[model samples]
Target: MDKNIKIADSMLDLIGNIPLVRLNRIGKETGAEILVKPEFLNPSGSIKDRIAKMMIEDAEKSGVLKEGITIVEGTTGNTGTALAFVSAVKGYRFVAYTPKMVSNKSRMSIMLAYGAESEAIDIQDYNKKMGLDADDDSSVHGGHVELLPRQICLDLERQHDDIWWARQFSNPWNVGAHHDWTAKEILEQTDGKIDAFVASVGTGGTILGVARALKAHNPDIMIVGIEPAGKAMMGAPDEYPLIPGISDGIIPQIFNSKIVDRVISIHDSDAIDMAHQLTQKEGIFCGISSGANVLASTMIAKELGQGKRIVTVLPDSRDRYLEVEKYTT
Candidate 1:
């Protein structure tokens, strides 16, 4: 028997250590090697599982999360699904506050399946209620679209003793998870030979965390971040689209610009096209952000040319996108 094949005590125990594989066909013309970490292989079918576990456990250790405490978070889909998965396994109630515009039936169903209660907040409604115009700079700025949902989480935490907000956006644990585990896994898997890293920025935790580790490993390693076109959380104008997993426009507090070398914006059509290619050619069933990440990775690979390696993540599975977008077909 192989010593590495030990059984896990629980699903939570299986969150990380996802394998990194090279893209054989998609980036063939790039010359450089494009490696992908299929984070969808995580227990909850998304990379968010890592931070969900990390934040929850850390809160438990700090005594902020207690018996019967409900875990609440503002998420698009993946984080909520992950928190629900972790909460269900750990015996905690979970609630997800999500943007009404980006809400998808499939994503909500997965969270509901895990016994999580989800509340979709309409940004337009919130803006109207607050007497702010939809086009107002304050309401349309980077990541402002998610502010209402996060505010709801904040209110719940402040009003109820039994409720604890996961705060995945501002939580240091979100960054810590990728830095300590995800990036370490990448470094180990690649034997510290990675020349670049690319990822689609949502809460910005993944890229920020991974950049911190990869840059520390080798400062010259380029770190690139992808955002939906015109919806960049850094400085671009806020825009709406079907790009479900990223660019909801609230520049998360965890986002740090210094470590990131470049920010690339990809259109929804481009992401969908890349997603189709990934599914059809490479057999990697991933979501739109994964498409953006992989697309950005290929661009980086082409720049670096032959012999260099670029690593990126397939952030989530395609199941959440089947009902809403043409991500696969």
Candidate 2:
């Protein structure tokens, strides 16, 4: 064997080992020692790359995925981008269903670039009319309608001899991916000195993994789950607009409420304001969910006093949200 020839194959090799940066300005401003795990450096420019890899690989291992089968999922942007990236490399067909409120430019561009098919779902007030019932197979929105797939349909597909859904919310693979990879990296980077972890609960996979690992090492470590004030049902909702936080309405099955010590709800405007501040001060351009996490983390730090170490994950890069004013700033 030639020494120069590498054993591993393809761009998939460049998946993990994202950098952890100390946020000096934000830390000082908040009176806490803050560290941010910059996940945008991953292959697909988001933390979802880890879950995408895990879901695909797990499907393969469990014999659910086969040659030429399509990978399908519902996403906003980041997860779809991640799926497209993985699907392109692995030679699988990728299809995504995203809500219309999501930035169209980003969704279309990412799908086109990665050769994935996309369908935009409309964001009607599903709660008031639909009543949490997934039974309405005939819901229509934006003049572009599609039938809602039943649980049986989903199950059949999973059993389908071939296709995989890569459901990020409930999939054990989602939690496992971060628990094995992200958590390990955090421990190594901090030399096992993490006092608390601050993260937004999107799918809840990131915080669950990080908290599990941190608590295992040091049980006293607190895990604070952050959400938009309008959607923070864990705590009292304080009349904030729903923007860039977990407004998906469906609580992920993988999220363990007991594991999370506290939940903080920040206003969307506050998050947007701080996100701009982050770009101006620390030069770290991140998504609004990250801003929510930072806002909550800073609040926690202020409450606990100084000298405490806290880490938060920046879920995606600001590039995805360029059309929004918060990102432009």
Model number with the top TM-score: 1
Candidate No. with top lDDT: 1
Q: After superposition, how far is residue 287 of candidate 1 from its true place, in Å?
A: 0.6
> Model 1, stretches more than 4 Å misplaced?
1-3, 132-142, 235-242
Model 2 agreement with the true structure over 48-133: per-residue lDDT tens digits: 88889988998999887878788887665677788999999999988777655443486459766999887665444442355544
Candidate 2 residues lying further than 4 Å off, grouped into runs, are 1-8, 29-31, 101-103, 122-160, 326-329
Q: What are the RMSD figures for all models against the true structure?
A: 2.9, 5.0
Alpha-carbon TM-score of each model against the true structure: 0.92, 0.86
Local distance difference test values of all predictions, in order: 0.83, 0.73
Tens-place lDDT per residue, model 1, 1-329, is 11265897788888888888889999889799999999999988999999999999999999999888999988767888999999999999998887776566787888999999988777877778878785443222126667888889999899999999999888998999999999999998899998999988777889999999999999999999887876556554545444666755666788887888887778778888898899999999998888888888888888899999999999988777787535545
TM-score of 1: 0.92
